[model samples]
Target: MTAPLLGHMMDVPLLVSSLIAHAARHHGNTEIVSRRIEGDLHRYTYRDCETRAKQLAQALIALGVEPGERVGTLAWNGYRHMEAYFGVTGFGAVCHTINPRLFPEQIAWIVNHADDRYVLFDLTFAPLVDALAPQCPNVRGWIALCDESCLPAMKTPVLAYETLLAAQDGDYAWPLLDERSASNLCYTSGTTGNPKGALYTHRSSVLHAYAASLPDSIGLSARDAILPVVPMFHVNAWGIPHAAPLNGTKLVLPGKDLDGKSLYELMESEGVTCSAGVPTVWLGLLTYMRDAGVKFSTLQRTVIGGSACPPAMLRTYEDTYGVQVIHAWGMTEMSPLGTLAKLNWEQSQRPPDARRALLEKQGRVIFGVDMKIVGDDGRELPWDGVAFGDLHVRGPWVIDRYFRQAGGTPLIDGWFPTGDVATIDADGFLHITDRSKDVIKSGGEWISSIELENIAVSHPAIAEAACIACAHPRWTERPLIVAVKKPGAEVTREALLAYFDGKVVKWWQPDDVVFVDELPHTATGKLQKLKLRDQFRDHVLPTAAAASEQCPMEPLDANIDAHAGGGAHPVKSAATPD
Candidate 1:
């Protein structure tokens, strides 16, 4: 006979509406603050937010919005945008957050691709909507996210957001939805070609929120005032909108002004205890604080993601400000949160430098996510941390397929290739070496451009740096360091090269350094390496001239600087080809 099975639990589906309802019922008095684009502060409670969200939902349904249809939002992080997120998803429709920073063509393409029936935008994007409306034919209506008095005089007819909500009675109940139904849509930043959409289901979003709010993740609680410096259009502000409400944390939304002074002021005024954003955002805040001779009083911790957090920035935040910096990693495909660098008990007891080294890596995976690295031969690599391979992930919240399967199945044997080259240590810390496309292969040996750039940026004179593979006849490809110097700081190539003398393997050093006024970045503030590569595609290296000018040097061993406490040794310069 078969073994007896345990009794099944409750049959209720995991819906997004339940999160708001719980917050309203239990944490109704908690504050949701916003620095509005209209140059004023807006404050409300969970009760008020839920009431307005319900009214907006009623308005949407009354305007002929059908279940499963897409509703687009082109606005900043504010109470109104939060209401739209719950209103659309709670009503069983998809909330599509469109990045306003994207080019007009790309924005139009995304709107048309999603077949967005209605687009609600902020007053700041009035001209953008007016210009793109002719291109997005499928977008049936435009609604400005403002009151009737504040609505802009647009070329096309547009409705006022507050007026629409005021017309609804808000007595409607949320429909019982299939947990697997699509609730949110976000597109990846199209670095290669056209962008691709990642449709998140209600179940996946809810689970992501739960996992993100755990102690090891964002660690949201009633007492913590959370500020999301990241925009709502990007990966649902890295899932903060949902996670904050689910955990009943005070929400402080920095609307459109993300400058250093603006963010610092918001943090102080709101008594922000924890925050989340990219490194560039924090860089500005740090610079502003340093210039103004200020410090964080209530802010205790920050979660930095979007790109690798520079070691210098991490040290500055911890050593100078007494604030803990949590390094996070994720992408649009993984619901934008895969790992957070939180130390365990044993790791927390380690020496300061050792713990700081661990903090440099991306943290361990949360409970709902699974991670592994595979070699070129399709074999799973060990967690020894020395062998790097293509990173792959699978989880309940991870995407099994993209919206409309734009490029067909993105999974490889049930696991999604994260397109990152990484290594995981015995303690489960993930160290990202580089992107598969960004890794430099020289003389059949792999070199990490990210490592070289990180070390370069640590120099006091350097403001920012990016390393790319330039053409080299002998090694096939050699690293070229492109940098932007700090204001009024004069530094030379030889001095910068000396900074990396003992830090990395001799051959892994950059072949040459070039200073530019600025480096290009993506709309999301990531280095645009592709554009850099294309710009320098046909350029020749300076190795030939250096070889003719310098004396021949001894060849260094393959395992240069391999042992601990090994002294720095001179190796053949880049001029001497392998």
Candidate 2:
């Protein structure tokens, strides 16, 4: 065998700190704007951000933070949290971003599991910090991401962020470290047991940032102002914090105000050209725009992910407001960027409906990622687009294993099982049909819950919808549509059941429609079907009965706000008779 040839090139590591330093050196004037917890917009340039980030690194060192130690943050998307993105990782420490939306117990468990030494939290989460301080004994200090005056009086001793920065002069250099050293940590929303962590290395994060900034991905550029309506605690705000700085694009952080009105105001005020978030957040923004009869002036595009974006939402954004919707899909495991639904030149020239139909799929993988589908027999499926199977992906950014090696090996034959049921067309576009566990098996055939839910939400009266499996006598399990209606909009179960006609095969149509006052969602805005399945585990489908009366409709909450935050959507109730 011939000896491996080595390329003669510079051996510089791809550190997260280098991204911010590059931005400061080249695009020092680019703004990092934040709607603060203190109830005002705070703005700074990349230069200022870099300097403070250095000071933060110095502060951490002064406070006895050691190399490779985990520093946890329970803050919103803001200037300080952005600094921590560079500072903590830059200082050779791991930046552990804890989702504040998780239960206090879960947060404490994560803190302990990560063995975080210092915890920094936004002022909005001060009370939460106080509650968690006693629980997280390993967290030596609790620092508020706020000024001294703005800091709330907590039972635990909390340090002020400004004070810590003021104590240090920006005189630190990012250390040279191995590219594969762990730099960031994020836990998956442990739906089954305890949440497991996805630890990211400097090399993977930097590579992810580069790929995510590509034209086919988020298409970031210097001229654009980007607002990450996605929480920073959630998959690094879908990698916008890094990509924005990498591209010298203006970063607009909407702190805590994820509701429709607040986000719309923030985007307009900042002249945001591009934004990224889940479907529920966009639902809020669209609701606000429709109610106010207003259109976005500067907003040109949006990246929707964290859940399957309904086609109706995409059409409304593009046709009504001239905003192009970039459908995206990823998980906490893959540095959270696997596929983006960008149309190729040929596909772009297609008719509006045809183009949208293509975009409704999860989209194609960017460079650095490889994906394939496998059937139950473990054989790879063909790319004919109709043959659905388990989606598996392997790439430089995807996790080889979980942090602490919690769940054993998640890969199968070198491919990471994405827990998604998908199909890849010959053109290489990936279409996510349903989650592996969420797919309903009626009789011997498989049914896509996502397809049914998408069709349900397409109905004007439906606000949000979830399709779950219901126990059956013959079929073993049948499709059930548990939906929420828009305020004051009345749609009977018969009408909804009939609405599915012609759109899908007769057997694939949901056997019953059960409306609820609200639907549960995960912290990242994904529909929580597990909870719904449990809630309706004993539900008796009307079809099974010989004769049944019409199901009683629950009264709609007159002032129900669909755009409300907190991982739950308000919905109206109406069920098919048993």
Candidate 3:
């Protein structure tokens, strides 16, 4: 016969309370440092963080922040945002992060869309808020993240964020949390379609945080000073804010200014060991270091995500800066941890250059996620790493449907279609070739825009490039290459086309090249291919006539740099939206 059943209560609240609550009982004297432009450089110990989060919870509840109501933020990567992150969610309210870089209308639309009752914004975003206030109807209060004297003179009802924190009494009774309660909500950049929210449950978020700290994952620990150059609005800053406390890592926030020099100062002063950001950010930093003679002898690791990280960029960091590049890939819907290309034994054994080549891949799928590639006929393909197909996945953390199934209600046996066309290697590494819609199909064959982009970037003369599907009459579609040059560098049509020689199928060469100042991007730094397609769709070399109609260009064998467009001197213009 069994004795009475015994068990430890399971809950996120319990975990957070232990982390912040009995500080000496769990993590005593652990440092939580935050820096902003002026005022006091706040230093909250783990115990202090706990006390303050509970206080903020009390303040939020006093302000009528009922469980599950949306609380939005338009702020930078600072303590104010961090407090809001924990305090709002700890009180069982949903934290909706509005991407401030989005067009004001888009920001207002998201705020109104979520029916957010209150907003906490960075002080630098004052004018933007002033312009958007009248548009967000449900928002009852606006809290600018500044000190009492720093409050901007504005027409709207603007209260200082720090003042509220100072006014909040440091005592709160956290509610009986429903682990399944919505904890955080973030929207995609809406490159392919309208932006939709991906609401994350507390359970999923906590699990992601746990998985993120594993040795095989980010492997963060207290000894490490972690800085996430990524914005908080982007999938909870890829869950770094929460994972840091769980892993006991000292966190760094760059605040409003995220330039390379600014980031460098923080990295040096904070003794930061690990950082993560999009490829564009590091590209700029690499240049900054070269010109300024800056060195990161202290930085050991960096995680690159958000877009395809070119191999050259990866090599520059690993070789010159003595930093290891950890390639990561995920989407907002996936709670953002899908794959990691960390160094394994075999991969580590490869020559540095070869290993850099492997790191260029999206890497193997992390645990808790299942991935597959399916042909147009909907048949699952082999993991040969060459046969590309639309990627579909499902997991406890990945979204089963978008915030609302906005991607056309695509329903399969149980998989959520991820739009990315990729191949899985025998080693389980997932290489994203291109978005299915961005791929160029000619004469019933598919050509990877990523393959072409990689080839284009290899050219010393070409600084960046983007490939879009240009209309072709006979073959149906061909790659129209848009490229940029280095400073004062000239690239003639023949010279650029010649670079593709002996690289890929001659027919795969771009039908025409357009010299563009820059390629457009969605709100989140992804190439806006749909817009590119619209801009060059009609300008492709007049397609070879069908056998029934007329002419055909010589087709044969040959070779090619992966190209990028977001490089120095990005020629910016209205890239007429698709």
Query: How many clashes show up per model?
Result: 0, 2, 19
Tens digit per residue, CA lDDT, model 2, 1-578: 99999999998999898899999999999999998888889999999999999999999999999989999999988999999999899989999998766567877999999999999998878888878988889888999888888878779998998999999999888888899999999887653356778889999999999998999999999999999877788788878899988999999999888888899888888899999876656766776787788889999999877655556567778888999999787777888888888889999898978887789777899999999999999999999999988889999988889899645888899999866677899878887655555655443234567778889999999999998876443343568899999999999999999999878667779999999999999999998876887788667676633111211111112111111111110000000000
Better of 2 and 3 by TM-score: 2
Q: RMSD (Cα, Å) of candidate 2?
A: 11.9
The per-residue C-alpha lDDT of model 2 at residue 322 equals 99
Full ranking by lDDT: 1, 2, 3
> Model 1, range 354-392, lDDT digits (tens) per residue?
898889888799999999999999899999989988999
The parts of candidate 3 lying over 4 Å away from their true place are 1-25, 39-41, 351-353, 404-411, 438-578
How many pairs in model 3 have backbone atoms within 3 A of each other, for residues 3 or more apart or on separate chains, i.e. clashes? 19
Sort the candidates on TM-score, descending order. Answer: 2, 1, 3
Each model's C-alpha lDDT?
0.80, 0.79, 0.70
Model 1 segments more than 4 A misplaced: 1-8, 438-578
TM-score of each: 0.78, 0.78, 0.75
Error of 2 at 388 (Å): 1.0
What's the TM for model 1?
0.78
Give the Cα error of residue 191 in candidate 3, in Å. Answer: 1.7
